[model samples]
Structure formats: C-alpha cells, structure tokens
Target: MFEELRIPTLWITKVRGENTVEPTRLAPLMQYIVDKTDKDTAVIIEGIEYLILENGFETVFKFLTNLKDNLLAKMRC
Candidate 1:
C-alpha cells in the first residue's frame, strides 16, 4: 500500500486495530510521521480542524497548497 499510492503521511486510525487505513504512505507527498502512534495517549485526527492539530505545519489557507503539493509530488512518478 505504501509503495502504490502517492499520498504522504497516511493517517492511521489506531482506535480499531493496527493499520486500519490503506495506502499507508503516499511515498511522494513527503511521507512523514515516524512515531505518531502513542499507545498511552491516543489522538483522534478528523474533520478539518484535526488536520491542523495533527499537522500543525499546515495552516488553513496553506492547507490547499500543502495538499496540492503533496498530491502532485506523489503522482509525479
């Protein structure tokens, strides 16, 4: 899954089980998040706000830019 798609930082929902989401890593949009998972502390990443909370590097206005850049980079191959 990581080697297939092109979206970086594949959001993982640890509520249900391990690796519940697909496309683990876009492999193009700068796949980040080395140690996001916290067994002791869980963070729910959802809605538009979650994007900012989880990925503070992106701002509301800059979100589109980041999204486009990442997506484009992932599909470049």
Candidate 2:
C-alpha cells in the first residue's frame, strides 16, 4: 500500500527475511530511523492490534510512549 502511494516504509515482521525488522526489536529500529531522518519525517505505525496481540497492551503502549517522547525530544533539539 505504501509503495503504491510512493511512501517508503520499513517492514516490521517476525518472518526473518531481508530488510525486515522483528516486532520485538521495534524500539531500536524506530530509534535508528528517528535519529537518521529529519524532523519532518512522519512515521505511520499500522497494525496496532496485531502488535498488541503479539506483545500485549502494556508493552506496546510503553513502546509507543517512549517512541513519542524520543521523537519529541529530538524535535526540541
């Protein structure tokens, strides 16, 4: 979907394939992208229900909160 829209995306999955990030390692992957990209970059996280089903609500929530905080901090800098 994103490809057809011309939006580049990094796929996060547990399939252990090339260029794919495992769901458990989402934080580091997201942090890496956040660090590398400019402030104008917009991260669209789909499949929240899937993530929650795989990792539980608390874990996903904390991950999202941390990501948001990190992005906000980066923007402030």
Which candidate has the top score in lDDT? 2
The local lDDT score (0 to 100) that residue 40 gets in candidate 1 is 38
What lDDT does each candidate get? 0.41, 0.78
Which runs in model 2 stand beyond 4 Å of their true positions? 1-8
Predict model 2's lDDT versus the native: 0.78
Reference-based TM-score of each model: 0.29, 0.78
Q: Which ten residues in a row have the lowest lDDT in candidate 2?
A: 29-38
Model 2 agreement with the true structure over 1-77: per-residue lDDT tens digits: 76798766766788877667777786767676676566878887878887788789999998888888888888899
lDDT of 1 at 50: 46
Model 1 lDDT per residue over 1-77, tens place: 63475333344443544344422222222234323322232223345454445556445336446655654554554
